[model samples]
Target: MIGFYGDIVFETSNSRILTFSELQRSTASRWAKHEVIGKKPTSEFIGPDLDTVSFTVNLNGQYGVHPRDEMNRWLIKARSGTAETFVIGNKRIGVDKWVVKSVSQMWGVILNKGEVVTGKVDIELEEYVERL
Candidate 1:
């Protein structure tokens, strides 16, 4: 199984699309390995300003047993390809973001401390940027 974390962008050309990434060398390395070698390594290269798709949790209040207003944000962009999802850890909660966590021909989903509830690929995007 192989997975990477970064922002994906896609461009349309003649009814076709091209994908690009703004990821770190480490994530890029892992992606390359999976693309070329067909195997997953143990670790990945970590760098600065790595734009990988991740979930941000806002821990405002509430503690012990039940929490209060836990909102998860998904940072998605254009150009990202298909991905897979998985469930990790002990907590079980409905996921709003596309979850792809593992090493396979499919994209892997990442969990905070390996705590996943449910996951799936959500590929839907609209043009958000224009250059004139």
Candidate 2:
């Protein structure tokens, strides 16, 4: 079986590709320094397991392999009152702000010779923001 997680793509003017995991690590590093202190850090996990922190992908859209010469870019949109946006890179570069027009859910499927498998994903941005 295949699994999916938060995946972001970044396109730089200088021709660079940035993945979501790379961006999250960078952001977490910066937050670890100033915000967290002493034994209990500000960014420390607060759930059943320390490893299961609420980390998410903040990508603008779907991504796939593209032919050369395409101007691929990474952009993110959030509401005005959103606080402490956890961007993968420097917010100034990684995100392009826009009003959220709508939110929706998506699913995927796979089929074999005699069987079909389906997967579902539901993301609620409002719920995540509330936790933050």
Candidate 3:
């Protein structure tokens, strides 16, 4: 089945559960410390920071409910720092409290009535943690 942001999911299966049409994820995040180096070498390497994971899911073809509703609400929610649970197939634990970073909506075919007959939604998710 597809995935969901917050409480929304795109059901692709004809049976019930929605699956992902296409999913792309960014590599693991790294930590770095920066300091002014006027004289000697800058040595402030304490430890690494929290990891951040990014995912882009494509909503296309006949699968699950149209994700237009969530996409609409995401615009407003993104500003409010809305955190949500993210699950893509077998999701790993501690990979919770996610938030929408950006969205790109592509209209493939539009009708004469100015309605999109075929389109795809690309959602970007970021992992958010409270503390380091």
**Each model's TM-score, in the order given?**
0.17, 0.18, 0.63
- Which window of 10 residues has the lowest lDDT sum in candidate 3? 56-65
What's model 2's overall lDDT? 0.27
What are the root-mean-square deviations of the candidates from the true structure over C-alphas?
Answer: 19.0, 16.5, 4.0
What is the per-residue lDDT of model 3 for residues 37-61, given as tens digits with 9 covering 90 to 100?
6865455655544434444444433
- Reference-based lDDT, each prediction: 0.26, 0.27, 0.56
Poorest lDDT segment (10 consecutive residues) of candidate 2: 66-75
Residue-level lDDT of model 1, residues 7-116, one tens digit each, is: 32123344433222332212122222224366655454443222223232212121111111111212222223233231223321222223332211112333466443
Candidate 3 TM-score to native:
0.63
Question: Candidate 3, 43: how far from true, in Å?
Answer: 4.3
Residue-level error in angstroms, candidate 3, position 103: 1.0
lDDT of 3: 0.56
The list of candidate 1 runs beyond 4 A from truth reads: 1-114
Give per-candidate clash totals.
Answer: 21, 1, 10
Q: Rank the candidates by TM-score, best first.
A: 3, 2, 1
* lDDT value, residue 77 of candidate 2: 29
Best by TM-score: 3
